[model samples]
Target: MNFSITRLEDWQQVVDKILPQLQHPILLLKGNLGAGKTTFTQFLLKNLGSTDEVNSPTYSIVNEYTSPKGKIFHFDLYRLKDLDEVYDIGIEEYIDNAYLCIIEWPEVYEEELYGMKFHTMNIINSETAREISFE
Candidate 1:
Protein backbone atom coordinates (compact mmCIF):
# COMPACT_ATOMS: atom_id res chain seq x y z
CA MET A 1 0.00 0.00 0.00
CA ASN A 2 1.01 3.60 -0.48
CA PHE A 3 0.21 6.88 1.15
CA SER A 4 0.76 10.50 0.23
CA ILE A 5 1.86 12.42 3.29
CA THR A 6 1.72 16.13 2.66
CA ARG A 7 2.13 17.12 6.29
CA LEU A 8 3.19 15.51 9.54
CA GLU A 9 -0.46 14.93 10.42
CA ASP A 10 -0.72 12.63 7.43
CA TRP A 11 1.65 10.29 9.21
CA GLN A 12 -0.98 9.21 11.68
CA GLN A 13 -2.93 7.73 8.82
CA VAL A 14 0.20 6.24 7.37
CA VAL A 15 0.91 4.56 10.69
CA ASP A 16 -2.62 3.28 10.89
CA LYS A 17 -2.25 1.76 7.45
CA ILE A 18 1.03 0.02 8.08
CA LEU A 19 1.33 -0.83 11.79
CA PRO A 20 -1.37 -3.49 11.93
CA GLN A 21 0.25 -5.46 9.16
CA LEU A 22 3.75 -5.46 10.62
CA GLN A 23 3.74 -9.07 11.77
CA HIS A 24 7.24 -9.57 10.38
CA PRO A 25 8.64 -7.06 12.92
CA ILE A 26 11.41 -6.13 10.52
CA LEU A 27 11.26 -3.13 8.24
CA LEU A 28 13.75 -1.94 5.65
CA LEU A 29 13.18 1.71 4.90
CA LYS A 30 14.54 2.74 1.51
CA GLY A 31 14.50 6.43 0.79
CA ASN A 32 16.66 9.33 -0.22
CA LEU A 33 17.83 11.93 2.27
CA GLY A 34 14.97 13.81 3.92
CA ALA A 35 12.39 11.50 2.42
CA GLY A 36 10.76 10.72 5.81
CA LYS A 37 12.24 7.39 6.89
CA THR A 38 13.01 8.86 10.30
CA THR A 39 9.54 10.29 10.44
CA PHE A 40 8.06 6.83 9.97
CA THR A 41 10.30 5.52 12.73
CA GLN A 42 9.07 8.24 15.04
CA PHE A 43 5.48 7.22 14.42
CA LEU A 44 6.19 3.56 15.05
CA LEU A 45 8.00 4.26 18.30
CA LYS A 46 5.37 6.64 19.56
CA ASN A 47 2.64 4.15 18.80
CA LEU A 48 4.54 1.45 20.60
CA GLY A 49 4.07 3.55 23.72
CA SER A 50 7.55 4.97 23.99
CA THR A 51 7.81 8.28 25.73
CA ASP A 52 11.49 8.81 25.08
CA GLU A 53 12.79 10.93 22.28
CA VAL A 54 13.21 9.41 18.82
CA ASN A 55 16.20 10.46 16.80
CA SER A 56 18.00 9.37 13.66
CA PRO A 57 20.81 6.84 14.02
CA THR A 58 22.80 8.26 11.12
CA TYR A 59 26.02 8.71 13.02
CA SER A 60 25.55 6.40 15.99
CA ILE A 61 24.39 3.59 13.69
CA VAL A 62 21.78 2.31 16.15
CA ASN A 63 19.42 3.77 18.70
CA GLU A 64 17.41 1.67 21.12
CA TYR A 65 13.97 2.61 22.34
CA THR A 66 12.07 0.76 25.03
CA SER A 67 8.35 0.57 25.59
CA PRO A 68 5.87 -1.69 27.31
CA LYS A 69 5.52 -3.70 24.12
CA GLY A 70 9.26 -4.28 23.77
CA LYS A 71 12.51 -2.71 22.67
CA ILE A 72 12.91 -1.38 19.16
CA PHE A 73 16.28 -1.01 17.45
CA HIS A 74 16.54 1.59 14.73
CA PHE A 75 19.60 1.30 12.52
CA ASP A 76 21.23 3.48 9.91
CA LEU A 77 23.66 1.33 7.97
CA TYR A 78 24.70 3.94 5.44
CA ARG A 79 28.22 4.17 6.82
CA LEU A 80 28.78 0.45 6.69
CA LYS A 81 30.81 -0.52 3.65
CA ASP A 82 30.50 -4.25 4.11
CA LEU A 83 28.29 -6.90 5.71
CA ASP A 84 31.16 -7.78 8.03
CA GLU A 85 30.62 -4.47 9.78
CA VAL A 86 27.19 -5.62 10.86
CA TYR A 87 28.63 -8.63 12.63
CA ASP A 88 31.49 -6.59 14.05
CA ILE A 89 28.99 -4.27 15.66
CA GLY A 90 27.05 -7.21 17.13
CA ILE A 91 24.00 -6.13 15.16
CA GLU A 92 22.63 -9.66 15.04
CA GLU A 93 22.12 -9.55 18.78
CA TYR A 94 20.00 -6.44 18.42
CA ILE A 95 17.95 -8.10 15.69
CA ASP A 96 17.37 -11.11 17.89
CA ASN A 97 16.50 -9.13 21.00
CA ALA A 98 14.45 -6.37 19.50
CA TYR A 99 10.69 -6.66 19.18
CA LEU A 100 10.97 -4.44 16.14
CA CYS A 101 13.85 -3.47 13.90
CA ILE A 102 13.71 -0.65 11.40
CA ILE A 103 16.76 -0.25 9.24
CA GLU A 104 17.62 2.54 6.88
CA TRP A 105 20.21 2.05 4.13
CA PRO A 106 19.61 -1.67 4.42
CA GLU A 107 20.84 -2.14 0.86
CA VAL A 108 24.30 -2.34 2.35
CA TYR A 109 23.36 -5.61 4.03
CA GLU A 110 20.26 -6.80 2.22
CA GLU A 111 21.68 -10.17 1.34
CA GLU A 112 22.53 -10.86 4.97
CA LEU A 113 18.94 -10.32 6.01
CA TYR A 114 17.46 -12.61 3.40
CA GLY A 115 14.91 -15.21 4.61
CA MET A 116 13.76 -12.82 7.31
CA LYS A 117 10.18 -11.65 7.02
CA PHE A 118 10.95 -8.07 6.21
CA HIS A 119 8.83 -5.33 4.72
CA THR A 120 10.27 -2.69 2.47
CA MET A 121 9.11 0.87 2.78
CA ASN A 122 10.01 3.06 -0.15
CA ILE A 123 9.67 6.80 0.07
CA ILE A 124 9.44 8.98 -2.98
CA ASN A 125 8.78 12.71 -3.16
CA SER A 126 7.70 15.37 -5.54
CA GLU A 127 8.09 19.10 -5.27
CA THR A 128 5.62 19.24 -2.39
CA ALA A 129 4.66 15.93 -0.81
CA ARG A 130 6.38 12.75 0.25
CA GLU A 131 4.79 9.49 -0.89
CA ILE A 132 5.46 6.37 1.12
CA SER A 133 4.90 2.87 -0.20
CA PHE A 134 5.10 -0.31 1.85
CA GLU A 135 5.10 -3.90 0.71
Candidate 2:
Protein backbone atom coordinates (compact mmCIF):
# COMPACT_ATOMS: atom_id res chain seq x y z
CA MET A 1 0.00 0.00 0.00
CA ASN A 2 1.05 3.62 -0.51
CA PHE A 3 0.48 6.62 1.74
CA SER A 4 0.74 10.37 1.44
CA ILE A 5 1.62 11.81 4.84
CA THR A 6 1.47 15.59 5.12
CA ARG A 7 2.19 16.07 8.79
CA LEU A 8 3.71 13.92 11.52
CA GLU A 9 0.22 12.81 12.42
CA ASP A 10 -0.30 11.53 8.92
CA TRP A 11 2.81 9.42 9.18
CA GLN A 12 1.49 7.89 12.37
CA GLN A 13 -1.69 6.95 10.59
CA VAL A 14 0.26 5.18 7.87
CA VAL A 15 2.12 3.13 10.47
CA ASP A 16 -1.05 2.26 12.28
CA LYS A 17 -2.67 0.99 9.14
CA ILE A 18 0.31 -1.03 7.96
CA LEU A 19 1.45 -2.61 11.22
CA PRO A 20 -1.38 -5.07 11.53
CA GLN A 21 -0.86 -6.43 8.02
CA LEU A 22 2.83 -7.19 8.53
CA GLN A 23 3.72 -10.85 8.21
CA HIS A 24 7.43 -10.43 7.58
CA PRO A 25 10.08 -10.43 10.29
CA ILE A 26 12.24 -7.86 8.56
CA LEU A 27 11.38 -4.38 7.27
CA LEU A 28 13.78 -2.13 5.38
CA LEU A 29 12.82 1.48 5.98
CA LYS A 30 14.54 3.42 3.22
CA GLY A 31 14.48 7.21 3.36
CA ASN A 32 16.64 10.26 3.98
CA LEU A 33 17.00 12.05 7.31
CA GLY A 34 14.08 14.13 8.55
CA ALA A 35 11.96 12.03 6.24
CA GLY A 36 9.87 10.38 8.95
CA LYS A 37 11.65 7.01 8.87
CA THR A 38 12.30 6.75 12.59
CA THR A 39 9.08 8.50 13.32
CA PHE A 40 7.17 5.84 11.46
CA THR A 41 9.14 3.22 13.36
CA GLN A 42 8.16 4.82 16.64
CA PHE A 43 4.52 4.53 15.63
CA LEU A 44 5.00 0.89 14.71
CA LEU A 45 6.78 -0.08 17.94
CA LYS A 46 4.22 1.71 20.03
CA ASN A 47 1.33 0.01 18.28
CA LEU A 48 3.09 -3.31 18.77
CA GLY A 49 2.63 -2.83 22.53
CA SER A 50 6.19 -1.73 23.30
CA THR A 51 6.43 0.73 26.14
CA ASP A 52 10.14 1.48 25.80
CA GLU A 53 11.41 4.64 24.19
CA VAL A 54 12.08 4.27 20.49
CA ASN A 55 15.08 6.25 19.47
CA SER A 56 17.21 6.28 16.37
CA PRO A 57 20.05 3.78 16.79
CA THR A 58 22.52 6.07 15.05
CA TYR A 59 25.15 6.33 17.78
CA SER A 60 24.66 2.92 19.31
CA ILE A 61 24.48 1.15 15.94
CA VAL A 62 21.59 -0.96 17.20
CA ASN A 63 18.75 -0.61 19.65
CA GLU A 64 16.52 -3.42 20.86
CA TYR A 65 12.98 -3.60 22.17
CA THR A 66 10.88 -6.50 23.30
CA SER A 67 7.19 -7.18 22.70
CA PRO A 68 5.03 -10.16 23.47
CA LYS A 69 5.51 -11.54 19.97
CA GLY A 70 9.28 -11.06 19.56
CA LYS A 71 12.29 -8.82 19.90
CA ILE A 72 12.58 -5.79 17.62
CA PHE A 73 16.06 -4.92 16.39
CA HIS A 74 16.50 -1.43 15.06
CA PHE A 75 19.79 -0.94 13.21
CA ASP A 76 21.41 2.21 11.85
CA LEU A 77 24.24 1.79 9.36
CA TYR A 78 24.84 5.47 8.70
CA ARG A 79 28.01 5.49 10.82
CA LEU A 80 29.35 2.31 9.32
CA LYS A 81 32.31 2.89 7.01
CA ASP A 82 32.54 -0.61 5.70
CA LEU A 83 30.39 -3.63 4.94
CA ASP A 84 32.40 -5.63 7.46
CA GLU A 85 30.98 -3.36 10.11
CA VAL A 86 27.76 -5.32 9.90
CA TYR A 87 29.64 -8.53 10.68
CA ASP A 88 31.62 -6.83 13.44
CA ILE A 89 28.37 -5.97 15.13
CA GLY A 90 27.32 -9.65 15.23
CA ILE A 91 24.49 -9.16 12.75
CA GLU A 92 24.36 -12.87 12.06
CA GLU A 93 23.59 -13.62 15.67
CA TYR A 94 20.79 -11.09 15.70
CA ILE A 95 19.25 -12.47 12.55
CA ASP A 96 19.33 -15.96 13.99
CA ASN A 97 17.11 -14.95 16.87
CA ALA A 98 14.00 -14.42 14.71
CA TYR A 99 13.75 -10.84 15.83
CA LEU A 100 11.80 -8.30 13.80
CA CYS A 101 14.59 -6.18 12.30
CA ILE A 102 14.02 -2.63 11.08
CA ILE A 103 17.00 -1.26 9.19
CA GLU A 104 17.78 2.40 8.49
CA TRP A 105 20.49 3.79 6.18
CA PRO A 106 20.27 0.57 4.26
CA GLU A 107 22.05 1.96 1.16
CA VAL A 108 25.37 1.08 2.76
CA TYR A 109 24.53 -2.59 2.75
CA GLU A 110 21.49 -2.70 0.52
CA GLU A 111 22.84 -5.61 -1.44
CA GLU A 112 23.76 -7.47 1.71
CA LEU A 113 20.05 -7.80 2.45
CA TYR A 114 19.32 -11.37 1.52
CA GLY A 115 16.70 -13.85 2.71
CA MET A 116 14.49 -11.11 4.09
CA LYS A 117 11.44 -9.13 3.11
CA PHE A 118 12.02 -5.71 1.52
CA HIS A 119 10.05 -2.50 2.01
CA THR A 120 11.12 0.90 0.72
CA MET A 121 9.83 4.36 1.63
CA ASN A 122 10.65 7.72 0.10
CA ILE A 123 9.53 11.15 1.29
CA ILE A 124 8.08 12.97 -1.66
CA ASN A 125 7.47 16.66 -1.32
CA SER A 126 6.36 17.32 -4.88
CA GLU A 127 2.71 17.12 -4.01
CA THR A 128 2.76 19.49 -1.05
CA ALA A 129 2.91 16.49 1.28
CA ARG A 130 5.16 13.59 2.25
CA GLU A 131 4.61 10.37 0.33
CA ILE A 132 5.47 6.91 1.67
CA SER A 133 5.37 3.71 -0.35
CA PHE A 134 5.30 0.08 0.79
CA GLU A 135 5.48 -3.15 -1.21
Candidate 3:
Protein backbone atom coordinates (compact mmCIF):
# COMPACT_ATOMS: atom_id res chain seq x y z
CA MET A 1 0.00 0.00 0.00
CA ASN A 2 1.08 3.59 -0.56
CA PHE A 3 0.45 6.73 1.48
CA SER A 4 1.42 10.35 1.10
CA ILE A 5 1.74 12.82 3.94
CA THR A 6 2.04 16.55 3.51
CA ARG A 7 2.49 17.37 7.17
CA LEU A 8 3.58 15.76 10.43
CA GLU A 9 0.05 15.76 11.75
CA ASP A 10 -0.93 13.31 9.01
CA TRP A 11 1.50 10.71 10.30
CA GLN A 12 -1.11 9.28 12.62
CA GLN A 13 -3.43 8.60 9.73
CA VAL A 14 -0.71 6.69 7.96
CA VAL A 15 -0.06 4.69 11.12
CA ASP A 16 -3.75 4.00 11.46
CA LYS A 17 -3.93 2.70 7.93
CA ILE A 18 -0.94 0.46 8.37
CA LEU A 19 -1.69 -0.85 11.85
CA PRO A 20 -4.01 -3.59 10.75
CA GLN A 21 -1.51 -4.78 8.14
CA LEU A 22 1.22 -5.40 10.69
CA GLN A 23 1.14 -9.14 11.06
CA HIS A 24 4.71 -9.52 12.23
CA PRO A 25 6.77 -7.96 14.99
CA ILE A 26 9.57 -6.90 12.63
CA LEU A 27 9.38 -3.79 10.46
CA LEU A 28 12.15 -2.66 8.12
CA LEU A 29 12.15 1.03 7.28
CA LYS A 30 14.11 2.11 4.23
CA GLY A 31 14.82 5.72 3.40
CA ASN A 32 17.48 8.35 2.99
CA LEU A 33 18.54 10.69 5.79
CA GLY A 34 15.84 13.18 6.81
CA ALA A 35 13.28 11.20 4.87
CA GLY A 36 10.80 11.03 7.76
CA LYS A 37 11.63 7.51 8.94
CA THR A 38 12.09 8.60 12.55
CA THR A 39 9.10 10.88 12.32
CA PHE A 40 6.92 8.05 11.17
CA THR A 41 8.32 5.79 13.87
CA GLN A 42 7.53 8.32 16.57
CA PHE A 43 3.96 8.41 15.38
CA LEU A 44 3.76 4.63 15.27
CA LEU A 45 5.07 4.28 18.82
CA LYS A 46 2.74 6.95 20.10
CA ASN A 47 -0.21 5.36 18.35
CA LEU A 48 0.69 2.12 20.05
CA GLY A 49 0.32 3.94 23.38
CA SER A 50 3.96 4.70 24.14
CA THR A 51 4.56 7.73 26.35
CA ASP A 52 8.36 7.57 26.24
CA GLU A 53 10.26 9.98 24.07
CA VAL A 54 11.04 8.41 20.70
CA ASN A 55 14.29 9.18 18.97
CA SER A 56 16.63 7.55 16.51
CA PRO A 57 18.99 4.97 18.00
CA THR A 58 21.76 6.09 15.66
CA TYR A 59 24.51 5.80 18.25
CA SER A 60 22.96 3.37 20.71
CA ILE A 61 22.00 0.95 17.92
CA VAL A 62 18.84 -0.03 19.76
CA ASN A 63 16.26 1.66 21.93
CA GLU A 64 13.53 -0.15 23.82
CA TYR A 65 10.12 1.27 24.53
CA THR A 66 7.26 0.17 26.74
CA SER A 67 3.86 0.72 25.22
CA PRO A 68 0.43 -0.07 26.62
CA LYS A 69 0.32 -3.02 24.27
CA GLY A 70 3.87 -4.35 24.87
CA LYS A 71 7.57 -3.87 24.22
CA ILE A 72 8.80 -2.19 21.05
CA PHE A 73 12.43 -2.38 19.95
CA HIS A 74 13.72 0.33 17.63
CA PHE A 75 17.06 -0.32 15.96
CA ASP A 76 19.25 1.97 13.91
CA LEU A 77 22.02 -0.03 12.28
CA TYR A 78 23.59 2.74 10.24
CA ARG A 79 26.76 2.89 12.33
CA LEU A 80 27.53 -0.79 12.40
CA LYS A 81 30.66 -1.78 10.50
CA ASP A 82 29.54 -5.28 9.68
CA LEU A 83 26.99 -7.99 10.32
CA ASP A 84 29.09 -9.38 13.19
CA GLU A 85 28.43 -6.18 15.08
CA VAL A 86 24.75 -7.03 14.89
CA TYR A 87 25.39 -10.32 16.68
CA ASP A 88 27.60 -8.57 19.23
CA ILE A 89 24.59 -6.49 20.18
CA GLY A 90 22.39 -9.58 20.51
CA ILE A 91 19.92 -8.39 17.87
CA GLU A 92 18.61 -11.89 17.41
CA GLU A 93 17.62 -12.09 21.05
CA TYR A 94 15.71 -8.83 20.82
CA ILE A 95 13.98 -9.94 17.63
CA ASP A 96 13.07 -13.17 19.32
CA ASN A 97 11.41 -11.45 22.23
CA ALA A 98 10.14 -8.09 21.06
CA TYR A 99 6.48 -7.27 20.62
CA LEU A 100 7.57 -5.02 17.74
CA CYS A 101 10.97 -4.26 16.16
CA ILE A 102 11.27 -1.19 13.95
CA ILE A 103 14.59 -1.22 12.11
CA GLU A 104 16.22 1.57 10.15
CA TRP A 105 19.15 0.96 7.77
CA PRO A 106 18.55 -2.73 7.84
CA GLU A 107 20.22 -2.93 4.44
CA VAL A 108 23.47 -3.09 6.43
CA TYR A 109 22.64 -6.71 7.11
CA GLU A 110 20.14 -7.42 4.39
CA GLU A 111 21.22 -11.00 3.89
CA GLU A 112 20.59 -11.96 7.48
CA LEU A 113 17.19 -10.35 7.35
CA TYR A 114 16.05 -12.36 4.36
CA GLY A 115 15.00 -15.24 6.58
CA MET A 116 12.81 -13.14 8.80
CA LYS A 117 9.23 -12.20 8.14
CA PHE A 118 9.24 -8.43 8.33
CA HIS A 119 7.09 -5.65 6.94
CA THR A 120 9.07 -3.30 4.70
CA MET A 121 8.33 0.37 4.16
CA ASN A 122 10.22 2.66 1.81
CA ILE A 123 9.89 6.39 2.32
CA ILE A 124 10.43 8.76 -0.55
CA ASN A 125 10.80 12.40 0.29
CA SER A 126 9.82 15.33 -1.87
CA GLU A 127 10.06 19.06 -1.35
CA THR A 128 6.49 19.22 -0.16
CA ALA A 129 5.59 15.78 1.10
CA ARG A 130 6.73 12.26 1.93
CA GLU A 131 5.54 9.14 0.20
CA ILE A 132 5.50 5.82 2.03
CA SER A 133 4.99 2.46 0.37
CA PHE A 134 4.57 -0.77 2.31
CA GLU A 135 5.27 -4.32 1.17
Q: Which stretches of candidate 2 lie over 4 Å from their true place?
A: 125-127
**Where is model 1 poorest over a 10-residue stretch in terms of lDDT?**
108-117
What digit string (tens of lDDT, one per residue) describes model 2 on residues 1-135?
A: 888767777867887778767777777777767777788889888888898899999999999998877898998888998889888998767766855888888777778777556666565554477777786
Q: TM-scores of all models?
A: 0.96, 0.89, 0.95
**Tens digit per residue, CA lDDT, model 1, 1-135:** 988879988888999888898888789999999898998889888988999799999999999999898989999999999988988888889988989889999997888877878899999988989978899
| Backbone clashes (count) for model 2 | 0
Top candidate on lDDT is 3
Off by over 4 Å in 1: none
Q: Report the number of the highest-TM-score candidate.
A: 1
| lDDT value, candidate 1, whole model | 0.89
Clashes of 3: 0
Task: Pick out the ten consecutive residues of candidate 3 with the lowest summed lDDT.
Answer: 108-117
Model 2: per-residue Cα lDDT at residue 122 = 61
What C-alpha lDDT do the candidate models reach, one value each? Answer: 0.89, 0.79, 0.91
Candidate 3 residue-wise lDDT, 24-110, digit = tens: 889999999998889999999988889999999998999999998788999999999998998999998998888999999998777
Candidate 1 shows a clash count of: 0
Question: Which structure is stronger by TM-score: 2 or 3?
Answer: 3
Candidate 3 to truth, TM? 0.95
Model 3 alpha-carbon miss at residue 75, Å: 0.4
lDDT of 2: 0.79
